[model samples]
Each structure stands twice: as C-alpha cells, then as structure tokens.
Target: MVVDGTYAKMWISKGILYFVYKEIYEINRIMAKQIVSQRLQLQNENSYPIFCDLRAVKNAQKQARDYLAIEGAYMTTALALLVEDEHSMVITQLYIKTSNPTYPTRVFTNKEKALLFLQDYKE
Candidate 1:
C-alpha cells in the first residue's frame, strides 16, 4: 500500500521482490510502483520530499531508476541510503543534500522519518 502523509510512496510488499535477476523481478517491482504512484500521484503535495524504501531483496536497488524514470518522477530522485546498507554508500543522500531540487523529490531512510520530514518541512 502507498502510505499517504508527507512522505508519499509505495511500500514494497514483503518478499514481493525476488533477489534473483530474473526478468520477472524487474517487471514485478515496476508494476508495483506503477500502481502506487498512480494512486498517490499528487495531492496537497508538500515540498517535504519523496522517499523510497528498498528494505529487502538486494536486486531492488536498481528499481529506483525504473520508478523515478516516470515523467513526474523525473524531478524525483531518491536516496535509498537508509533503506539498506548494502556495503555501498548512499549516493542519493549526497545528491539531495548538495544539489538543488527542481521538483518535490527527496528520499529518506525509513518511512517514519521521511514522513515526518516531509510533513513538517517548511519551504
């Protein structure tokens, strides 16, 4: 389900994503995000930011590209830094902190903090 608040995003169903790089994995993840984004398109949209969670299924990291590649989401870049710590650094965090945002896009660790930041953020 897409949790609505300050942080609008789709929650990846537990085990919905498969760790295998099989073709189905990508398709499934994409389909799931597509459904959620459509549901939570934008409403009373806040400048708070956008956050995506990749809590499990290591292969899902690249799904961010597919999810954000959408039209409105282009301005939406995500930092999956907090969602997972897969031996790699969170490049998206640096992107958000150092760069300027043309759109309402920002990603955080867990949904709670992200929601809080987006909900309470003052423009």
Candidate 2:
C-alpha cells in the first residue's frame, strides 16, 4: 500500500513500512502527527520495521522532532533513517541521541545497509 501525505509519501512492502519525505519540505508538529497517523492507517495496527527516507527534507522543528521520536514510533518495531547529506545525517543522529527512542533506530547512508538493519525486525 502507498499513501501520499502533505509532507511525505508512505508505503508498505514485504512487511516493512517506508516513508519518503517530499523534496525541500519542512516538518512541524502537526505535520509530524499527520505523517504518523497516515502510517498507522496504512499498517492497519500491525507493527513493522520502518525505513524513513529523509534525504529530501529541509528542516524539522523541535516539536516535530520530539513528536517523531516518541509518538511517531507507534506500530513500528524498528526504524532505519536513510540520509545522504550531512545535514540530514546530523539531524537524524541528534534525534536519536537526544530523544533516545526505545526501539532499535539507526541512520544509514546506504539503502542496502538500512534495509539489512530493518530486515531483522520484519515479521
């Protein structure tokens, strides 16, 4: 299944959930909630390892980041953030370090590595 939201595009494949942010998009608290809600709807209450592609995101507000770190984790067994740019990588690292998400979360520049990390949690 695939869904297009205001800030991102979401889909599910092979027991994994994928979220790819729209190019140059900025995310706020409300947008964060909406994105999570969209994912929840797509997965239909089942948990999956999530692969979030943030390569196109411009910025995410602190509130959005906080919400994504906690509430955004719902129905997700693990999370793999795919980033190529330094800015996105730094932001992801900061989110992981400061927010301290309970689930297994990691950042990767390579898609294959990210998939491999998430594959372990796939059900």
Best by TM-score: 2
lDDT of 1 by residue, 1-123 (tens): 433332224432321211111122333455546544543444223222344454543343345544544443442323222344523226555544555444444554555655554443233
lDDT string, candidate 2, 5-87, tens digits: 87789998988888899886678998889888888999898999999998888788989988988888888899999997767
Q: Indicate the worst ten consecutive residues by lDDT in candidate 2.
A: 84-93
Worst 10 residues of 1 by lDDT: 14-23
TM-score each candidate: 0.39, 0.93
User: Candidate 1: TM-score?
Assistant: 0.39
**Most lDDT-accurate candidate:** 2
Quote model 2's TM-score. 0.93
How many clashes show up in model 2?
0
